[model samples]
Target: MKEEIQQQISDALGQLFDAVSKLQLAYPGKPFTPDGRLVGDIGEVIASLNYRITLNEGLTKHHDAVADDGRLVQIKTTFSDHLTFPVHHVPDYYIGIRLQADGSFEEIYNGPGQLIFDQLVNRKPTRTGLHGGLMSMLKRINKDVPDAERIPQR
Candidate 1:
């Protein structure tokens, strides 16, 4: 059940990524990559206010991203039904990507690309869900900031 849901999410997010890439390609000067630090979503959102964003692959490995604006973005992703944020210090920004069987993928930009997912059931999705999860994670990193104070202040 969980796997299925994950696949659905991955497919949807992949669609979203393609669309984002196309939009950026049309404009140029903007680069987009995937599978990057989920923490960079913040920088991506803030930077998107001006320069074009590329979906680089660094969005998943870490919790950080670099923006043309010279700012850092830290993105966080979750599959909570209530869309409630964690109380303790968490990622600078949060994104909730619901898993649906629909063929449509929507970015549904909230403030600074921050959004809370609502009413989603837990199910096993196909491998496609991995991709969607990947995008979600990357988006989170893009939104998150490199705060050593919270993670490892070392």
Candidate 2:
């Protein structure tokens, strides 16, 4: 059973690698580094799939997607160990997705835009300075708004 599970895992990873490689090829001159924008694209795809949201493929000023209920969603994804929330445009909600090394992902935080902005405003160095990662932001949210609802990973 263990061997079978391992084989399944290996096959799934191989398929993912192949798909990512093809995607990399599609974007010529772009290096597929861990911290590259392509990884963020993957995160957006994941978020879209998980939330049943439609992505704004081309360049846009604000949110990444509009939820089923018509709420604007800004998605922030990180393959690295940190998360930074930009202070520019405010969406209806913010979805933070953390992609792990083992092909798993965590929805670190999914909450109201105003709550996130408030946390950022009070905690961040400047209005433009990026906020900290998952735990830090969560901590700030918990401290400030004890009754806020955070969407959990599905």
Candidate 3:
């Protein structure tokens, strides 16, 4: 039963991949794919990215392949029209990936690609019986560590 649910989520993510691709193509890179890490960081905001990741398909390769190629992305699959996405600090943290122009589920990163899950997660969309819990969590852990202080400001 859980496997089926995962597949359903994966399939939904695939469709969201297509939908986001069409949206971008229609607007000529105006919008990008959704971020999954943001959702995982918070609540179920994963469904907000307008995309989804296959629990069995794009997991291993995403971390090893795409990210290895100088990319960091969170894959989310869903079956809704809401275009919410989470926010993050790292470059590879919340970047969105979708089916490329050539019908491939490859991940991409850039400006719009950098919207962390926090930015898209609906504040009041239903949470752990609390509001902004996920958002707050993300904000809490995302505190900036001063590299200069650690290695001498000079």
Off by over 4 Å in 2: 1-33, 123-129, 139-154
Task: Kindly state the number of residue pairs that clash in model 1.
Answer: 60
Give per-model TM-scores.
0.25, 0.64, 0.27
Give the higher-lDDT candidate: 2 or 3. 2
Which of candidates 1 and 2 is the stronger one according to lDDT?
A: 2
lDDT of 3: 0.35
lDDT of 2 at 27: 95
**Residue-level lDDT for 44 in candidate 3:** 28
State in Å the error of residue 30, model 2: 18
Error of 1 at 16 (Å): 17
Candidate 1 TM-score versus the reference: 0.25
For model 2, state the Cα shift of residue 68 in Å: 0.8
Q: Which stretches of candidate 3 lie over 4 Å from their true place?
A: 36-38, 41-154
Q: Which ten residues in a row have the lowest lDDT in candidate 1?
A: 112-121
Tens-place lDDT per residue, model 2, 69-122, is 667788887766677676565567777777765445776667777777765665
